[model samples]
Target: MRAFDLAASAKAAAQAAVDAAAPDLVALSHRLHAHPELGFAEERACGWLGEQLTEHGFTVTAGVGELPTAFVAERGEGPLVLGICAEYDALPGIGHACGHNVIASAAVTAALALGAVADDLGVTVRVLGTPAEENGGGKVLMLERGVFAGVHAAMMVHPSPRERLDPTCLARAQLHVEYDGRAAHASACPEDGVNAADALTVAQVAIGLLRQHMTPDQRVHGITTTGGQVPNVIPEHTEADYYVRAATLAGVTDLEERVRDCFRAGAVATRSRLTLSSTSPAYSEFRHDPGLLAAYERNALVAGREFPTVTAEDDRQAGSTDMANVSLAIPSIQPLVSIDSGDVGLHQAEFAAYAARPAADRALLEGGLAMAWTCVDAALDEGLRARLLAGATAGG
Candidate 1:
């Protein structure tokens, strides 16, 4: 067989293997969806993923990077190290509404399928259990600790309302602001109190006005956690959480400085002491490697999946993810896999329900097979691999 024919055949075999593992994969996905854990607290999800990989003959190492929820599983050996990134952290209250269960299962399925033909493909497969993507920068921490050291390329499929090869994800910076003031009875001696709530109001108004000068793609929003204990008394202290995003990390840094200035202005305007802290490191923008994306798009099409053509308007509405940080370090793809969750958007209770439904199960299987085939194509096609490496290195 010619090289392309060999790759096609290997991909076919991998898809068949994934089909055979469909039942187990679906069950695992449902289990994870049913018991959603948030961010750094995904201990149960991490253990389950490690056990599944271990059972599938991959050497599993739990607690990677001193993180209780992080793990690394490896199989095969060769110069090309293919990384399958898995995320299991759910949203705080709505749970697996973002379909992390699908992500976790897809990674496992792809790793197993690729491992079955790793020897012939001449590549290594590593399944990385990266937690806390919703809040803490788990992958960023792992990257800093040398967890991804030798991986040639990394890949993961994120569940979304639509299927797309490359959706623009914004760089993000999270801020925590606290304002301190003096308390007094609301109706009595109100003049003696410095209102922290007034400080937050000032900051919010400034942010609203700042939006007029920002790029249309920029997003600045936040919630006040503690406006006041009671309406009868002035609030002695108030806190708020804000997330500011931009098209790139440098843009995010600049926007963040302006946001801090707004907070400082609020302090000055309200006579309250303001303190600002970053809750997490900034998440960078995603860098797309066209060669790798083309391979993935081909594999996805063969697996009966089609991605929609996204336009500038689509780019205007973007979300932030730590996966962007991974793209900066290595060749990575974070394509969206649709779950047919209706109008119920991510981080909603209804979407969480769909995450365990039959449609989601099908998405898990198809996404896994497609990602596995993409890896095979990458390893079997030398030109494409070199292009991906070059693109990643140049972008880095």
Candidate 2:
């Protein structure tokens, strides 16, 4: 009996498959970029990715984990289940500023390519349509609901202005804070008004002051979703949403406790009712599997992707991702695939425009091939395969 050399022939096949699917993958990326959808509302993106998988002979289950946009697409019957995380949710107003369209496209291409050789490698390929990485923790919710039940190895590539392996990501939690007060005419009887706006002001000031006490890695930021209707009417109710980020989940937990004190201070100072609650489940920090990370670097290099020699201090990735939560339960890696976005930062409108450019399209193809090759490499390596097989199943 002769064993196939997955590192040699299988590599070429995977790359070829990605090349063959380049046109459709590019179209998918562009379509997602053109029609932006917010977190948990990625109907178009979800339907499109799922349809592509279904057309290519994958068994796709939509609306998994109680999320309308979440889906799981699988092929092959091998014991080793490889999970590909596809994030397609866009920012609130900036569209696909974080280039999740590229992420989704890459995941689909990787899954398709891997599916072609899954049997030979004795592996199962699963592409997960994970939504709402922008603001909500859709993956977190899905994980809690048992969506990622049988995945052995999970992998995804995020788009960024620069390429890097094992990039640092923060753990964060979202907070919804509100203040309720009595309303009165501002000009006529200002003294009688228990101003909700003032309460929010006190909270904002407290938050600013609290920042001084926090570590450099700790961050707290928010926006007033509803401040008031008019200046004449003293604000009866004020609401805001904030994000508290830290280097780790424990740090985020500690910071949230401190931050809530600031919110409570507003109510105490203004004699108003304070309502503060978590908007979504907390996102954990990224934990990269060293084996998967090395495989991806090698494959990315073969795909002509280069790591940056110099990166700006401020340009480093610091935002939270729901994919990080997947790492907690599965052996995973969520590396950044660099695109030529110039100096524009992610979550900015200009970055969203760059997400649809030719460079980003190239990233979609190359990142897919790299990830597919990595999966093949992992499946072929005896040690890596054994390790992955021994791990608990996350999604299949």
Candidate 3:
């Protein structure tokens, strides 16, 4: 049958296309790792990725979605539109600690592989150069700006310590909590001064005690950015940033309210002014499409990648991602591709050092091929295509 032939041809071509581009993809990952850029400032990473897409006959658009570093490269005019996300942001000090270089290169390769068969499959392939995942929420902004309005389904693989079919990500909200008070000479006019540092200290202590009653899926962590200029004078101003995460967006709201109350208690006890605000939109919890996830698992297994059995403990340790916001808008999946960083967790120097290692390079090819095959499978399957289109229509 023509359908069987197209499926077999697409599967083989996807693997072959990624294999042919393996060297350049690995080199691109290394280049991105070597020159790490912060979120929304990934000029070089965005330009390099766009260059590759342009060379591959894609119409590249930089500075899309009102974000300068955000770009999208597109090809084909068919019915199905597949959005492949490429994240290239690095952490402040740990540079590439999350292996975004691996993510960017693999996503591009996957798009290129799909481009090879787009005409035969009557599909349109797109590679979205999403610029921020670490410090800025680029994807969230793009989602708000209608950048992904017409996208049917999205897929991007994250590099991690171990492979996962689909990750369990927590919803997170960023917060800024500050206190203001009067300052005076510590010894001479202690009664005239209201110690802002004391307010923060009280808040921290309250949070420490609050841990006792924390639910299994609730998490709150913060760092004091300012305490005092010197210990001799009473501190007048103090500020802190915190991230509140929970199993769902509603849970994030509930946890944030309780956490704010702890900080408010500090301000009340010290007679200091309380200021609280959210730094960005809360990143939502992810919901993976079952059809796409199943297709990805099959492709990954055939490409010599195996996933460890997922457990609740794994969910407890899962990190939050802005891709979760994109999932809320469209059918999306962010699968984890393993790197050989034993005992070295993400956002650490050790993990950054191994991001471009041999194992990581291997992961780049496997992940790209697996994703490309997944898309191919989806295109070739009638029921799956209809389901994704129906979802897109409803999402619209």
Candidate 4:
């Protein structure tokens, strides 16, 4: 039988610790929301989060995995190492629209709470300052470079419009396509110009048509970053960024090849030079640990967070994240913590406005506490701990 008494005691201690740090945690969330930074450029957010972790007695490593903005904070010397991921990178143009501010603060809160009883529970808590979830795949790079070498399991809570125990996280790849062609005045010597913009248009049209034959779960979306220098001049160079997503990494890779053909077709038709490159490593599908997810669901429910009934058809929360990459390597979970921004979805300017509100603050605290409590439960459950430890050893 599990040591219910010890778990209860440790949970109380964790709750008290989080409650004591509530004001500071909420402030941190608001501060990050106020100063939104883009992926791989989160200098201020990284420094501020590191400072908070340092103040709470974690050994903070400023840079890890060759990423200047990525860091790892650790506390305790227990046998089972638990990783709590913190994502502070904001979306470009939308600014904090994805609510990474809440993610970072909640991670800090979980780290502090777990730190309070780490020794008692025989659990070493690790807080990973993961950057570039919005663009560069920071966690994917870090995982490849051994930043998560000793972590037995990992988890993080992402802010959303509704509470979900396990959100649909797809495997995704970012592709940057560039086209180069001869430039000429629109009216003067127009025949001498090779329109790069036309190449881009052809590629887009192909992609649009390709969508019809694609599987229901597959997604292909992109934006034109550059079209032309001036309307009066034929475009000499054009560039676009695209994301191809599917149910699995292998599936995405296959889909990526087909997508590349579309871009190549554009070049063939317009006789423009085309260059294709990946901006970051492809993210993998999430594999959530059932035990951890169940523990978190119970804890979240007890914290007064409700998961409204919704069928998969009605749920539009399917998205891509670097956290999914981490989940593939370690037993992990990324639960969706609701900010109560009804009808205001993620990546919207209106959602950014709600990220710093009272509702979001409440979700931050509740999510953190649930994560901490789940950690306590994991530490107290000897069977789960042994399994995680065994997996870590085997993985090593």
- TM-score for each of the candidates: 0.96, 0.96, 0.96, 0.97
Candidate 2 vs candidate 4: the TM-score winner is: 4
lDDT of 3 by residue, 255-285 (tens): 8998999999999999999999988778889
Clashes of 1: 0
Q: If ranked by lDDT, best first, what sequence of candidates would result?
A: 4, 3, 2, 1
Where model 3 places Cα greater than 4 Å from the true spot, the runs are 392-396
Spell out the clash pairs found in candidate 1.
none
CA RMSD per model (angstroms): 1.8, 2.4, 1.8, 1.9
Clashes of each: 0, 6, 0, 0
Give the clash total for candidate 4: 0
Per-residue alpha-carbon lDDT of candidate 4 for residues 319-347, written as tens digits (9 for 90 to 100) = 89999888878999999988999899989
The top-ranked prediction according to TM-score is 4
- For residue 160, model 1's alpha carbon misses the true position, in angstroms, by 1.2
The residue-by-residue lDDT of candidate 2 on 130-158, one tens digit each, is 88888788999989999898888899998
Per the 3 Å backbone cut-off, how many clashing residue pairs does candidate 3 have?
0
Candidate 2 to truth, TM? 0.96
lDDT of the structure predicted as candidate 2: 0.89
Give stretches of model 1 more than 4 Å off: 311-313, 387-396
**Every candidate's lDDT:** 0.88, 0.89, 0.89, 0.91
